[model samples]
Target: MPKKDNFDEARLAEAIKIALAQKKPNIAKIAREFDVSRTTLSDRVKKAITPTTPTESRRNALTSYQERALVAWIHQMCNWNLPPTRQDRQVGKNWAYSFMARIPAHINLAPVKQKTKELRRI
Candidate 1:
């Protein structure tokens, strides 16, 4: 595997400043000097004064503790010489749906409809 390169904007900024002061801010030359692509240097220049916030993403249905509790329940059930059957699995899934619903909607969960579809497919 090739070595991973980390962006060092602070170091690049220092080099760019010197080039700018000399009235010779060449993207290709700066990129070559910095051992990076010209596109990377151009992208740095394109960025605004203010750093942007990271994009938001969907979250899990349950918190770590809650998820662990559910997993533990399943494990206990299996160890008790009683693995859940199809119906039992459906019940467990329904219980999970209800559990997810009791929490904030921002806590994303797989819809119950998804489970229903899988059941039908099976």
Candidate 2:
């Protein structure tokens, strides 16, 4: 397997800043040239440009309530009862959603729908 490239936040931030300072930010072109995904580039730009609110910081950074709710939401949407793993336990739910969100929507696994007949049989 090829070695994975380390994604340094600082480096990404600088690249995003340069792109933004240009007359017009061509996000797709920048992503193709840099060999980074558009979503990754967009995330870096959002982080570098958007000002964080106190409530957002407090809620997203320091709380588990939101994370748990997000986890529950994802589980429901995906129709999986799979429990969170050790890494999930370590980072909490907010990180989980953040990680999941990085995956392209087109690449998602097939949704697992509940079987009403199976439930009735049980």
Candidate 3:
């Protein structure tokens, strides 16, 4: 199981800034002042660990551009009545579904048809 981060990223960034601004930086003091983890602040100040935003995934096999391209390809294949084969996809089995969930407006694998205006009268 992964440990949840109790500290806010913004607070950590602020702490790193304060620590770096000082002539003789006290990581522990800055961390305590900003309510961030001492070790994390120290690591960031020392450039020991690279900072990553919340949306950045370390284990992603494809970039966002690549994912969008794959979605476009899937849409194109469906339009041509030639659904992609399993061997055609290089991504994991769940990647397509997950990608759709992430950005539903971009591509919908299965869109339901709405009733016509005449059908509403019945």
lDDT of 2 at 77: 59
Q: Give the top-scoring candidate (TM-score).
A: 3
lDDT of 2 by residue, 1-122 (tens): 11337655665666687788987788888766666667888877777678876653443443566655655666665655443343335456566567566445664644455546467667
Every candidate's CA RMSD: 13.0, 15.6, 7.7
Models 1 onward score TM values of 0.31, 0.35, 0.45
The order of the candidates by lDDT, greatest first, is: 3, 2, 1
lDDT of each: 0.56, 0.62, 0.71
lDDT of 3 by residue, 10-37 (tens): 8887787777778789888887898777
**Stretches > 4 Å off in candidate 1:** 1-29, 39-59, 85-122
Q: Which portions of model 2 miss their true places by more than 4 Å?
A: 1-11, 56-122
Model 2: lDDT equals: 0.62
Output the lDDT of residue 17, model 1: 62
Query: Which 10-residue window in model 1 sums to the lowest lDDT?
Result: 108-117
| Clashing pairs for predicted structure model 1, backbone only | none
Q: How does model 3 fare in lDDT?
A: 0.71
